[model samples]
Target: MAVSLDMLSLLPDPLLIIIISLLPFKEAIRTSVFSKSWCNNKLFKLTTNIEFNELFFVKSYQPSIKHLQRKAFLDFITFWIDNNKESIIEKFSLKLSMPNNVSELTEKCIAFATHKGGVKHLELDFSDPKWVEYNNVAPYHKFHEPMFALPKHVYDELKGIQILKLYSCRFVEKDLLNFHALKEVSFGWMEVSIFLINSLISNCKMLESLSLKRCWNFSEFYLRDRNQKLKKLVVDNCSFQYELFRVVAPNLKFFKYSGMMSYFDIKGCPQVEVADLDFSTEFGFGGKGYRLYNFMEDFYSLKVLTVCSYFLQVIPHGSDMLRMERNFNIRHLTIKTQLNKSDYRGIVFMLRSCPMLQCLTIQLGCARIWPNYAQPFASAPKNFWTENVRIYECLKSSLEVLEVKGFQGFDKSEIRMLAYFIQSGKVLKKMTINMEKDIILSCNRNLDLNPRKFAEFLLKVPRASTDLEITIC
Candidate 1:
């Protein structure tokens, strides 16, 4: 072991730095003790990415320990920044486990890394458990002081930053006229206002991707981009109400919205090709019933789409094909929803819109049904297979691959559904089925649960396409 350790010291300095930089901060510092030759070497000076979290700096997970080592932790961080002041850091991440009385120290450390080392990717997670417990507490309260604040001057000074991620922190507005280097921004578990969000979008001219997760206190969100710089946008679990959320990005390409059943007016995004919408319709679905159809209309150029039953329930049923204003040029479609008898219509509804569909994926899970019992349980039209073959031309000629996950081979309905696809898919090349539970590897262990027997039984079924490869796993 000692000889092996000595051999590591003889390696080139760049390789040693790469190995050290991949480790946590404390582990990286311990590399100096490997051999006498590595002592006080350029490991600290050459390292670029630095990450500090509770696992490295904190002695214990108890919240009480936060106060005990608060000062020493701050002092150590200040010393580290000064030691690596000359290094060109590409990424710096800091995550505090608990709330501390001295929050300014963290702010200063973050500012120093961004302003001095020219860090391009900065992630700060200062979330405290107490914030969620006392969410009713006003932002001006003393407890809120522990939340890291990204002041306007910090953004102004760090003009070269391209990716900025913040969790449970505050974004303050400033005269950010020169802040144009940002290409991506993400916010999670934080409080943000409409003005700050607008400032971020308007000031960052080069931003291409933006994500908001579990952010609150904003009811309405409006975005209009004429320059087409922002291409990807994600709004996950945000507080949005009926008809209050609107976006107009002419050149935007990718979009995903997951939240309550809200009205979305996303128009002019002609370049959009991929979309994922997972919103709940438990609320009143009257005013927002037509929103999904309208939203789909704006994305006529979409090639990929993912949706839940909430989107399917809004479309009228009983037609061989869904009544759509225009057909979609979708090539790949993914459906994540509970598979009951009536839910099959939703799958066909998607197939009706995407005439150019090729790859299809269906995941069985829980589906959110309407709250009122008045809504009829719409099943597929009589002889749904004949209608599928008659209406959806893709199933006959274009669809080549079909993948069904969480498949229970014993279920009669699931087996029948699979058989219909096999009989109808004329141009199908590959069919993959993933079982719900692991089958016994040894036949002696459990004969009935053997996967080989199951696959053999499925192979006996008739297939429309002669050149098909069926894989069971």
Candidate 2:
């Protein structure tokens, strides 16, 4: 142990600071006892992303314990914030369950991080302690809102602010708010006015990414930028009240939307490389639905695409769509939907369109691995893959990697699809199959599925490519 400590002490100061920064607030502070080398004031300077959470230390909401924990957390935070005085901080995060009246301390902490210290990223989460159990239904959880009053003194300090994330917070739009260096901003479970949202975007000239999740009290969202530098945008579960949803970003490289849009119009985004659309009934495509097809008709620059089951239901199958339009540049594809015999056609239809696809990922129901853009939520098992002979006409020449999750190994449609790919992909290099034993057992309750036996069966299947690598999990 002493030798290990000596080795750690020999690490460069910058590396040591980074190592301490990633640890929890208390754990990071305790490292001072590890060695004299770790006790330098530089450790305090390295404390950039400071985070404090009272609930993490307190087991229950007992008034006495809660009070004590809050006091201790406040003192600890104040000490560090002051210790790092006149220094620049990369991030400062806090999670609290305090009453709205006592929010002065929270504001003070923010002021210290932003006003005194140059904080580039700030995150404040004051939602319900048990917010994980809440639903998207009307009358959502109502946690006390921390009114973030960005007075001139506080707003001016945000010149270096690149990322700002807030949860269950409130803000009143004052004057022209300008975060010149802001690049990414996200607001979740917050009530923000449409005017304020537009104003915020208009000021962030260098903004590259923006996400609004479950933000309420908005009837319409209009996103139009002639000099836009945004590369990624996500608007998920936002309640626009089925009103107008407009976007006209010319430089957007990635776009994702999931919500109800009564009147939707998207134009001028010719640089978009990837797009994910989750459509629902409230999307308002009454009759003149052909316009929807026309909208996507010119996505020749799109290299990757992921569409939900509802999107597949609307678009017709066959090579006609591909034949009529310019050849797509799509080299990677992902589809998320329920798959039985009935939905197999949807997968086949989508595959026929992507002739240059090099990678394919399919996620069904609970088996969803993450959509590559967003952070993954759960550990996804890896199982069945490949396409049928028809896929040979489109993807066999270019498709190199195939990944499938939540494979039950019972559906003949799925097996045929997998067999076709394995036998037809002449250029395929690697294939991954993630199977769930529970799903197989649910299909065949009387018999258990043996992963090893299944692997043996797959190994026996003939492959078109001699160097094909297969992985089953």
lDDT per residue for candidate 1 within 1-473, as digits (tens), equals: 34344787788888877877777666776777776666857564566777766445556557688656655666777777777666667778887744345557676667666667377888888876444432212111222332666655676567788888888777654644355788988887876666676667788888888888767667688877755788999987665433478787877899998776556677667788899987553453443445566666677888998887666666543232365657788899988755554456566777776777899987655434554422235445344444435536788778999988766544456666777888778888999987644332211122234578767767887888998899887
TM-score of 2: 0.77
Per-model TM-score versus the true fold: 0.76, 0.77
- Candidate 2 per-residue lDDT, tens place, 216-268, comes to 77767787664587788898767665567777788889988775433556666
Q: Flag regions of model 2 displaced more than 4 Å.
A: 1-5, 11-15, 18-36, 39-45, 53-88, 97-102, 129-153, 261-263, 280-292, 317-324, 366-389, 409-413, 436-448
Q: Best by TM-score, which number? A: 2
Question: What is the Cα-based lDDT of residue 374 in candidate 2?
Answer: 22
Candidate 1 Cα outliers beyond 4 Å, as residue runs? 1-12, 15-46, 53-87, 101-105, 108-112, 128-146, 151-153, 175-178, 284-288, 317-321, 373-391, 408-410, 435-450
Please estimate how well model 1 matches the true structure, expressed as its whole-model Cα lDDT.
0.68
User: Could you tell me which residue pairs clash in candidate 1?
Assistant: none
